[model samples]
Target: MKKTNIFKIAFILTIGLASIFSSCKKDAGPAGPQGAQGAQGPQGLQGTPGPAGSTVLSGNGTPTSTTGANGDFYLDLTSSLFYGPKTAAGWGTGFAMKGANGAAGTNGNKIINGTTIPGATDGSIGDYYLNTTNYLLYGPKIASGWGVGTSLIGTANVKYSGWATSTDPINVGYGKTSIRSARINTTAITPAIINSGVVLVYARRNSDLILPGGTTPLPFSYDLSVVENIKATVNFSLGTSVIYINTTTSNNSLYAEATLEYRYVVIPGGVAIAAAKNINLNDLQAVEKYFNIEK
Candidate 1:
């Protein structure tokens, strides 16, 4: 009687357990809340820039009678000007896109012009200094401390080229038609540039790069100088500037007969000596690079 009772009790217990499990139809309670996401990884290196598109035409010089569709455009690497929207006649006149001029960079209060030891708060890590006392420029305030200031005075002072002249000349002008000049776009000389303190620095191409008025280049050691050569003179008015090549030293020729091309640079404030010693002034490239200029 005891064995039978024990077996019956065990069977009843097992059946009760199975019924309890069966009553609960759910196998897993509604899925638990999703785990939090893991932290993201660091970013990869930046990619390089792409090349120019098909629509752009890169050439040695500016477009003249070169033909192009209405949508087509030309980039004169020599002239550094962008010309486009060509019609059936020829390439339309365009403005200068990039040149050796223009204030592509900005200098904050970092450049201390007066004579004084710049305070720590005067400028940040890369700020500059110029002690007028010594005309010593840009100590280049650094993390450790202000670096030894570089002297940009006397002979070391670089001349300025605030305004970049066109590779070509202003072909059309009214003044004394006797002067030889290049085809220069009026827009090349900005009003701000003309209005700024600047002086003239001209470059003469003895041989026309693209015109019939070219000749054997003269062997002149001083090709680029502030000194006036070839009876060259510039007349500035409003936004337009005209350079008159009155005569050529290489050959005694009349302006009407000679097809010459002139390229000039106008350094604002006459010479760059008056500019800050922090960086080279009048050079578009220097400004662009110093200020991290980009598209």
Candidate 2:
């Protein structure tokens, strides 16, 4: 009986061990939810830079070299032209930068400036100077030292003297009745003004300073101020510097009385400038307004 009991106990323990081993061999349960994704990879290396663009250049003459890179510009001062936007082939066609060659210019005179008066040795003939103290302009230095310095402001050196008149006309020689006139003293007239400056004249008549028709509107039907030579006409004998208020007839005749009044003006420039401005010599009021002339 004791032996049989021992065998039964061994058999029971073996059966329990076999059951536990079978559970371990069964298939695994569904996989748990996937875990969060892993971290990102590292950055890549940088790329190389590109080549530079063009440049500009200039020279006295044509370009002979291809040393300059593509898309460049070159100027030729000798030819006054431009060659450019260079290509791999070479410099492009050249085009003129200025107009046709002009006439040679006159030599320019030298100039000097100082607080003291300019000495003759300071500059050569035709040279100029400016006084720092008075702001006066001195020019075309001569063998002598500076003369009077001109003021840039105000009118030129023309003197504004009162009106001068001629003495009465007297018949002279064989041309007596046909041409009579008076000569007035004109020491004030300068040779320089007559040569290069401007001169203007205005005329009137009688002690009352009336028009040539003598106190009447233009185109007089009859003669006025003709006590003697009624056939003679009245006009001007210009060029003795502001002239003779002479009496002249048809183009074929002459003779004049010094019985008229006259006035004059002077400007500095070519006569063409006065004509170009379209001055009306007959219009006293207009002339006064344009040139600031005194009545």
Candidate 3:
């Protein structure tokens, strides 16, 4: 009877163990649906500010109703500063210094009417003015009342012998004078002469006078010889003063005769000459037509 009880207890224990193993075993199947997504994280911090840019012109600060006169207007910039057209009051507290003026607009050619030429006192040099009285156009005035129509003329002469050394003063019929003098010889190419007045000298061989040189020389030959072919240099002084002529020569065979020509004009008091005008090209065309240079 105890042996029968032991066997029954063993069978009961084995069945209980099999039931536990079957309950733990799992069968393969599809995965369950994924869970819902989680919420997003908090926002990031803000970035730093960027560098400033170049200043820009905003607008004219002057009132809209009034046109800006030279010193009345100021310019506004992106930085909120005011710059100017400087006035006597200057750029005050809120304003920056004045800026340079803008480029000037182009001007048209000037036109003059009539012949009563405008007096020199009337306009600036290079400014053109017309004379209404005469039909002629007068301009490019050099001095008071010294316009295109005025002129003076005169004549004079001087004679020198080859033996003369130094200079001889000559009084040309004109009131003009001499300022300088020089001489040119066969050996030298140039002579020193003055800037004013026209003086021309002619040299000629006087007779067949020969010093210590060969005979039968070539005619009109300007060479180094006993009869030196010397030429006179002449110059005149300012305003009807004195004129000088170089008359020195190594030989006595050369003689010189000079002729003088001069011209001048008288200017009226307080009547200055006008300067050339931009219209001078047209004026020149008219002048050329008047002189028959252009048909």
Candidate 4:
């Protein structure tokens, strides 16, 4: 009986310990399935761009070529260029650009031609004696009228009283002003069949010969008589002909019409007369007497 009780007590104690351990382990709930991955957050903004690379030309440049024996360099300017204004045709190689043309020469010198003694002379019509070989018995004086010549006649009568200012009657020409005067009249003047010669007339102004206004000189009429510091020269061109004229020594005196004069008038009718009396009327306008230049 004592051994049975001891065994029984041991068995009870073991059973009680097992029951306590079982209670402590209450059931672990099934593992929760992973919640759908949280929706992905919005993607971050893109990064900034890097620096630019080196420049590169896109199309082919003008064709580089050597000239042929005929001195011809043909280039087709079909390609676009950055230069302003379209290029002109027939442009040569080396591609150097050209600047605008320099301004044209000024027009102030006078041109005159006549049939009587139509050659350059040292004296004026009033003072110039006919080379005698080609003068009429009695003709007009130098200061007043023209003489016969081959191609042109020029005369200078220096009435130098004093330098006339722009406001002076001589400079502005009121009426019969007493200023020094030079006259150049181109007449197809013919000498008396008795005694006659030829003269050559050159049209020259003060030699400085600068472009008017130092810029582009357009085609226009200018009165050389009104110009300042102007001295004229006369030359004759006798192609295959000898010209002569006759004049008395009295008509060729210095300080007479032979002396350089500085006065002239704008003869509207005179220009027409000069044209009608000479060949190629278009070439004999008074404006043409001053200076003529063609672009």
Worst 10 residues of 1 by lDDT: 215-224
Q: Each model's TM-score?
A: 0.24, 0.33, 0.19, 0.13
Model 1: residues with Cα > 4 Å off, grouped in runs: 1-179, 188-196, 199-247, 253-295
Better of 2 and 3 by TM-score: 2
Model 3 C-alpha lDDT per residue in residues 1-295, reported as the tens digit of each score: 9999999999999999998887767544678999999999999999998864333233645323233433544456443556444445554444545566799986643545544545556544444555544334455444564255211111111111222222344233212222224322221111222232222222223333421232211111333443445432322222222323332333332243232212111112221122122112123232222222312
Candidate 2 residue pairs in clash (backbone atoms < 3 Å): 179-255, 180-255, 247-256
Q: In candidate 1, what are the lDDT values of residues 180-212, reduced to their tens digit?
A: 343344443556566664433333444442222
lDDT of 4 by residue, 168-237 (tens): 1111222332222232332333232113332222121232232233221112122233344232222122
lDDT of 3 at 32: 100
Cα lDDT, model 3, residue 165: 28
Q: What's the lDDT for residue 221 in model 4?
A: 22
Give candidate 1's error at residue 53 in angstroms: 72
All candidates: CA RMSD (Å): 34.1, 19.6, 21.1, 26.8
Order the candidates by TM-score, highest first: 2, 1, 3, 4
Worst 10 residues of 3 by lDDT: 151-160
Q: Is candidate 1 or candidate 4 better by lDDT?
A: 1
Compared with the true structure, what per-residue lDDT tens digits does model 2 show for residues 1-295? 9999999999998998888787766755777999999999888788798887778788888886664777888888799789888887888778999988899999889877888767667877788888775455677777776554654444444433345556555544343344556544454446666667655555555633234443321112223334533454544444535445454443223322354445555555553253324445455444444444455
Each candidate's clash count? 12, 3, 21, 66
For candidate 1, the lDDT comes to: 0.48
